[model samples]
Target: MSIQVGDRLPEVVLKRIHEGIESVDTRALFDGRKAVLFAVPGAFTPTCSEKHLPGFVEHFQQFRDKGIEVACMAVNDPFVMQAWAKSQHVPEGMMMLSDGNGDFTRALGLELDASAYGMGLRSKRFALYAEDGVVKQLHVEAPGEYKVSSAEYLLESL
Candidate 1:
């Protein structure tokens, strides 16, 4: 079953690009905080690069102002995620987390199989608002749809 409001996010390790090599615990990222976590199919893809990620990047400050931490996840390597964040001009305070092995995605029961497109296992586009590691709301997009996971949707939900 898909994760829902009131669910505690699973514990998973994610690779992060920091000063050197750094691994982050997914639960630790959300523990004791309100956070908006969004997942995309891949990094550097057209919609993700042009719209999905930019929407969050543009509204990151507003999210923080509302006392929420914002994070983006993709089933790509840390190096690729880092490059994509730089290319998208991600501001400080927004985290671009790499679910490189898809462990986190699977743990959330949100993994998408896109092998037909040669993308392998990926994440469905979705957003979640969580408080102290428990989800408060979830917005999961229908396949090929982008209506629900946008920054506007998240802001309104908040």
Candidate 2:
């Protein structure tokens, strides 16, 4: 089932490109803190690269000012995520996390099979606002839709 508001985020370790790898225990990252976790289908895709991730990057400071740590996740490997972040010039406040094996996505029940688009298994575009590891709000976009999970929407929810 799709994760819902009030659900405790699943504990998982996701890889990141920064040499100091982030072996995140979801509870450790979210429990005792406010965070905005957003997911995309894959790294470097046109819509995701040009729009989704950039939206977070652009408004990262606003999120921080609101006491929200922002994280972006995709199904790509760490290397790809790192490269994509670098290319996109992702600012320091935003973390690019990799769910390369799709374990975290599966756990959230947000995995999307895009083989028809030649993308294999990926994450559906969604965003969650969590405080103390429990979700406070969740926004999920319909396939090919970008309205709900946008930074503006998330910020409004916060």
Taken over the whole model, the C-alpha lDDT of each candidate is 0.93, 0.89
lDDT tens readout by residue for model 2, 6-100:
89899887888666666766677678999999999988888998899989998999999998999999999888988999899999868888898
TM-score of each: 0.98, 0.95
Query: Candidate 2: where are CA atoms >4 Å away?
Result: 20-22
Task: Write model 1 residue lDDT over 40-72, tens digit each, in one string.
Answer: 999999899889999999999999999999999
- Report the C-alpha displacement of residue 110, candidate 2, in angstroms: 0.7
Query: Candidate 1: where are CA atoms >4 Å away?
Result: none
RMSD of 2: 1.1
- Model 2 lDDT on a 0 to 1 scale: 0.89
**Steric overlap count per candidate:** 0, 0
